[model samples]
Target: MDLAIETNNLKKYFGDIHAVDGIDLQIPRGSLFGVLGPHGAGKTTTLRMLSTILHPTSGEAAVLGFDIKKDAREIKKRIGVCPQELVLYPRLSARENIHLIAQMHGMAKKDYKERTDELLGKMNLLDRASSLVKGYSGGMKRRINVLMAVIHEPELLFFDEPTAGLDPQSRRVVWDFIRDFQEKESTIILTTHSMEEADDLSDELIIIDHGKIISQGTPDELKGKLGEGDILEFKIKEMEQRDEIIELAKTLDFVRWGKPVGKHRIVLNALDGLRRVSEIMDVVKVKMEDISVRKNTLEDVFIDLTGRRLRD
Candidate 1:
């Protein structure tokens, strides 16, 4: 396979902190690859190194076949980076912001004009394109930020939490844009804390924690690693009873594992889940407010591997 991005023991450090510790990756061309982790798991640092915004302390990587360290400028030219924090000119109008980015990328005026108009229309911001970015809603700014990144139509794109604060409708629009890009054979690397977004958008994903990869595979493959089972979630009427229900679940032979989630929920991994539901429910029947059973998900895989939830 033709790899769009590859890294070999990539490491970055800040004093004693190993922000990105020895990550090796092989992302194929045209794949919507996902990097998932919690707040301090080095997802942003890793992306910064890949996009040539930060030089790694050690190790190496290539983006679109150009060395990130030695050919940083060349790599920058072929890649678009939508950072976790918005990087827009608040004083500029939305169209002006995109136009400025296109100019910086050395795009011809005619090309950029057409590209900008098309993107604004697609994002449903054509009517507001003349408005200053400082006055735009958070979601509108995010949408413009994304457009600015791709104004030059780069071959490889890096989106760091692209839909972080978008409403459902706006988020779906971003998702659709990503899907359309993938269909056109552009390699996209995305980092997100949202498991649902990762599951829905990623062709393959890696879950990172403490600057190291704990799990990596297709969504279904990662879930399969949890073994054959259904995930049983119970919402208790009283939050104080969570631990007791989890302890009771642990005592069941059919249950592989159980843990308290949030304040009122207890999640369990069980075999023959349908057949065992009644037996499982009987234990928590008195305290249970609601219950659900489903196949394992990426979130469950994260909890199982890291011993904590994704947001933690």
Candidate 2:
């Protein structure tokens, strides 16, 4: 199999801080890959090194077969990056921003015009192409930021929190765009905090924490690591009852394990959760509310592996 990106013990440091420490990855060509972690987890720093924007303190990586250190320029030409923060000229119209990026990439005027128009149409922003970015909503700016990255039609794309703050509708639009791009056989590296988004878009994913890879697999494969069980979650009337609920849940025969999510919530792993719900309720019905049962999910896997919520 052809690999689009490869890293060997990739490390980056700022003084004594190991921002990205000993991460090894092999991303296949034309695959949609996800990197998931919380704030300060080095997701962005790792991407920066892979994208040739930062030099690694130690270790090596190649993007699209070009060495990240030795062939940084070549790698830059074949890759596009959409950073977590908006990077657009507020005074420029959406069309102009995309046009400028295309020009910088050395695209022919005719080709860029067509490409810009096509992207705007797909993003549903063609009608507002002439509007200055300053007048656009946050979602609109995000859409334009994405368009700017792909204007060069790069072979490898890196998106850091592509839909971080968009409304649901706008976020879906971006998701659709990503799907369409993948159909074109472009390799994409995505970093996000949204477990649902990662579950939906990634062909494979890795969970990173404290600058190291904790887990890596397909979504189903990762969830499978958690074993076969349904998830049971409930909220208590008082924060003080959380520990009591967890203890009660653990005592139940059906509960495999139980933990307190926050001061007022408890989550449990159980088989046949629906059938066991009545039994679970019997123990904490007086203190619990908003009880729910569902199948194991990526979020569950994340929490179980990290012992903390994804957003933490």
Candidate 3:
């Protein structure tokens, strides 16, 4: 497999804070890779380092096989970074914004003209092409921000919270553009707080916590590590009742384990639940309607690993 990006022991320090603690990452060409973590998990910091905007405190990173330290100029010319913060003149029209970015990248007017128009059309901003960014909606501005990154046709793109603060329709538009870009063989590195977003679009997912990489693998690969077939979640009104539930749930042979979802919510892991929900429930002496059953998921894996939600 070809690597479009790589890092070894990448680290960044913000005074006393180790903003990006040693992290190793590998991204394959033409794949959509997601960097997922809670807010302040150093996602933006990592993107900045990968884009060559912020220098690493320690370790090595490369983009498109160009050493990030030795070939920053070439790397800058070949990659695009769309930060989480909005980056637009607000006074410029949507079309004008893309044009400004194109010109800054030293794109030829003849070449950029058609490419800008094509991207505008793809982002569904062609109709609003001339409208000043100041007058555009949050989603509209985000669409244009994304267009700015791709107008120059860079080989790799970095998107930080790309669809954040957008309506469902605009989010879908952004997703489509990403899908189309991948189809054209563009590699993307994205940071997102949305688990579903990562699950839906990423071929690979990396989870970070407190600036350190905690998990890295394909989505299904991580999910498969859950080690159980079905998850039974029981929400109770009181925490003191957990002892009774745990004692009752352990009587079933199919039940691998039963634990607390929180102080009051209990979760049970059972094998062959399709053949055993009734049997398990009988052992627990709880009504089937009282418990909720869900397949093991990445969310569960995160909770198990960190003892908290991905957003926490």
Count of backbone collisions in candidate 1: 0
Q: List candidate 3 segments past 4 Å from native.
A: 240-251, 256-267, 271-292
Which residue pairs in candidate 1 have backbone atoms (N, alpha carbon, C) closer than 3 angstroms, thus clashing? none
Candidate number that wins on TM-score, 1 or 2: 2
Query: Candidate 1's residue-wise lDDT over 19-52, tens digit each?
Result: 9999999999999999999888999999999998
The runs of at least 3 residues in candidate 1 whose Cα sits more than 4 Å from the true structure, single-residue gaps closed, are: 235-253, 260-265, 271-278, 281-292
Ranking by lDDT: 2, 1, 3
Better of 2 and 3 by TM-score: 2
- Error of model 3, residue 2, in angstroms: 2.6
- Pick the winner on lDDT between candidates 1 and 3: 1
lDDT of 3 by residue, 1-312 (tens): 799998999999999999999999889999999998889989999999889888999999989999888899999898888878789998889888889989989999988888988888888778889888999888888988898888888899998999999888889889988888878888999899887778878999998889998898988888788776787776677567677877787777777666665556777777776667777667766543467778877766666667666765
Best by TM-score: 2
lDDT of 2 at 142: 98
Q: Estimate each model's TM-score.
A: 0.91, 0.93, 0.88
Worst 10 residues of 1 by lDDT: 281-290
Candidate 1, residue 308: lDDT = 77
RMSD of 1: 2.6
Residues 78-157, model 2: lDDT tens digits = 89999999999999999999999899889999999999999999999999999899999999999999999899999999
How good is model 2 by TM-score?
0.93
